[model samples]
Target chain A: MKFIVSIKMVPDVYAPFQIKDGELLMDGDRTVLNAYDASAVEEALVLTEKHGGDVEVVCIGSAKASETIRKALAMGAAKGYHIQTNGDETYDSSSYAQILASFLSDKEYDILSFGKQSQDTDSGLTGGMVAQLLNLPYATNAVGLEIEDNKLVVKRQGDSGQEMIELPTPCLVTCSNDMNEPRIPNLKGIMASKRKPVESLSVSDLGVDATALEAVSKVTSYEPVPARAAGKKFEGEPEEIAREVAQLLDTEANVL
Target chain B: MSTLLTYVAISDGKIKRSSLEVLSHCKSIADAGGMACEAVIIDENATSYTDDVQKYGASKIYTVEGDAFKQHQNGSLLKALTKVNEVAQPSLIAFASTEGTKDVLGALAAQLKAGVVADVSSFNFDGTKVTAQRPMMAAKIMGNVNVTGNPVLVSVRSGSYDLKENPATAEVVSVDVTVESGDLRATLREIISATGDTIDLNEAEAIVAAGRGVKDEEAKALISELASVLNAGIGASRALTESGVYDPSLQIGQTGKVVSPQLYIAVGISGAIQHTAGMANSKVIVAINKDADAPIFEIADYGIVGDLYKILPTFIEEIKKIKN
Candidate 1:
């Protein structure tokens, strides 16, 4: 039951929206694994620990992705593969998944996992796209999963509730936040992670043609939403206040 | 450009306002190119909503009927959706952003080999090309995406678009799909409704949210006070929700509810991207934090850089006077 979990280090969501003409803007400081992907990693770790298998993490991005690799290792992954020296922050999920599928074709891993969606882009496309590329059985927002006789059984969340699914062993699942609680990094685990073996392979070295990718971008502008006008306060009975609010919604705001 | 239609709903069978907003966005997309708007409804009773769908401007609807179809189960839904795709061959697909929507949509996209753009706030048309705007650094840096495939897919964040009820009537077409009883693969068991006096944040017209900057639990009493005076729902950031003082439903952020009330008031929240991405779309965003440097100010329509504990009461008093 070998496993591969993809992890991404996303910018802190607490930062301000940066919409300038020339330079990119976002929080520059702290880096945490995208929340949903964290559940994916934790699920992979839990699966490997239960099934008696070594787990490897495959991270595709610039050197910044190395932090993702280190975090995966610290979380008890046996090792990690860094697809390094590459990545534009805006790479389309199709290209990213394509690059990884090509890499996975030459490798052997039973199961694949990733965040249901990235916090940065909120595109849960990477895992699904990779699974499509590989032509494997895939599930997303899997809340319940189990292994039986080399096949996989999972419960995926739907709009109203949940669904049960059974597929062969070779598949991919994008875990959501409630999949599992991500373990906190301990001092010992962090220290031991340094000793773990990590192999960094560049896209060019891995037989990937760097120039074949498309360069696409969207945001021509980013700006803060306009402020609201001052509120008109009211002091009266609850029913009276409701009447005033109704009037405001009907007259001044005309939103009622 | 290919047009995709996303359906938005809340607990039980209520049509969420967010879904209406997503429909508005879909309208904008259809107008961008020659894209036609079609909706995929999984609710148990779709016939009752045809008038409502028309009000949202949908030209056609692919209604899936069944008790099983009522609740969203990713696997069964993926299979059912696969069946629908095989039939309708819609050029694009879309869904409202939700935990359940994200899950089934990911599987649907992968199993169908479609492209995905999740949590998009805005999108523009370039002739036949569709460019979408999504949050990159939480909501700090916006990223653009161009979908090249025929069946481009997207999930609209809650409340990002202005909802409009179009006048045209929509055609409801029922579709039959096979979903085996054994095929029920996931279990939601139950939805432990959150306990609180506050209205559901997702459904609220106005929200007054609090954060950790409130020195103690006693401070939440003030949040309730303000909410009561304004006839608004109460909300809390993830920090406060996780702090065990509030129910999970009250939590507002990327991991929680994405609220877009007409008026959003924040107390002690320091505008983190995780937090802002949830409430940035509010019609009027107001933040009050002692620290003037709080990032919340960036998105806030109004900011009073003063202690929330002191200002909230005074502000409520001021509003009370104005109302009288």
Candidate 2:
């Protein structure tokens, strides 16, 4: 089964940053492939590797996104499609979903995949939005995926339990990072990625009205999360401190 | 008057308290803004929850009942929500963020052409727009978001607002929905439920989370005993869950469940930012780890430097004594 996975380039959440006067100030330009998308790419690669098929990735980002696409190519994806955008546009989940939907409108694929949510934003709306816009069957927060009887079986983590769902071909799924540990690209794979093909296109080239892609929801500002003040730390004999803290929970904290 | 509709979520034969919390908040907003407060419950036994839902001050209750609504299917849910939105014509639709809501929120928004914000910790609707604050960059920072549309959609994280009871006499309105077989693109095979009577960590008042230090069955038993003593839910760090020591449903971290319980006890957890991102909002945090300098201590209201094997037994015994 051929798979087309939608990937994203996000700011590295691990990078050191500061918020001042409602503005987030990062230390440097540290960007990486979204962790959840990396898992989606990895899962698609694994499935296509087992069954004889090709795994392709489509990404929506600025010029810097080619590095991210190469990272995926280095991990064994057969091809990449970069939907280039000006970095300054304030695009929300809906905008990205519309762009991806327009790009994938006439594309042929058995399964369309995406990360459940971006690591930085965590909005988790784009995948479902794209599925809806494309009128495709979809599932989200998938922890396990398997191909059986020409169908995609998804084990999605729900509120009550893990639900096993089966969808026919031409379906969509948003993968959770719990699915698998993404493999790092080796030296040989990196060398091969340099020779891989990456097709770059503008939003207008996809026949989408760029003016209609206005984001209804936008982040107005950033602020530091109020720090939780640390209380007293007791270090002494295990039994003594344990009993004392338990009493404190009852009398002082009133939680017990 | 414009309506503010709250989607009351049902899980495991019970209405989610978080949904009631959202309703309570919406009711207050409606009252202050001079708008009508309403609610929608889409379930197999939707009408059964009407009385309980009325306690939160929904003047009108919309119920969409059928066997197709028995389980969480995004197709049926999106259709039901769309129908309800058409009937109610709500200016703002609110939801208590759940896995079910997350599965369908974006699709519903896209279908309705409505602006949406998900997993917001706090939000308010002004006359013209809805503004919300949510954790970004893995809870390392907060982002204020503004959403604009005819009917703005917002999902609130559990524990973001306190539950305030304001009873109202609600008029029950049954919504007609038909889910043909063709509409269901995905079929649920089965559910691998967690073992019996495991409290939901999202709604738990207190949580006892095991980390890497909880290695053996003995430590697991101790953690269980402590949780039982305090009537708290049992959770696990990503290390324990990924290592197959605990169920994935019990995993508490950025990639897992983001919880803000009344009390959170971290046993044997050397709190990484990823883990703390989920539980940092707990009202009271207690960290018990042998490593005195564990980052958990930085945010824990009470930090005890000790081993779990020794500390847990004494701690559980003392808590049991205190409860008695």
For this target, which candidate reaches the highest DockQ against the unseen true structure? Answer: 2
| Per-residue lDDT of model 2, residues B128-231, tens digit only | 59999999999989999999987999999999999999999999999999998788889989889974578998889999999999999999999999999989
**Residue lDDT tens for model 1, B8-115:** 453466776667777777777776667777776766786676677677778877777777766655556766678777766766666677766666565566567665
Q: lDDT values of the candidates?
A: 0.69, 0.93
| Pairs of residues clashing in candidate 2 | none
> What DockQ does each candidate score versus the true complex, computed on alpha carbons?
0.22, 0.88
Tell me the spans in candidate 2 whose CA falls farther than 4 Å from its real position: none
> Candidate 1 — which residues are off by over 4 angstroms?
A1-3, A9-54, A63-67, A88-90, A101-111, A131-191, A199-256, B1-11, B28-35, B181-184, B195-200, B213-231, B288-299, B302-324
Candidate 2: tens digits of C-alpha lDDT, residues A1-256: 9999999999999999988788888854699999999999999998988887899999988999999999999999999999998888988898999999999998999999999999999999999999999999999999999999889999999998899999999999999999899999999999999999999999889987766688889898999889899999999999999999999998998987
How far residue B187's Cα lies from its native spot in candidate 2, in Å, is 0.5
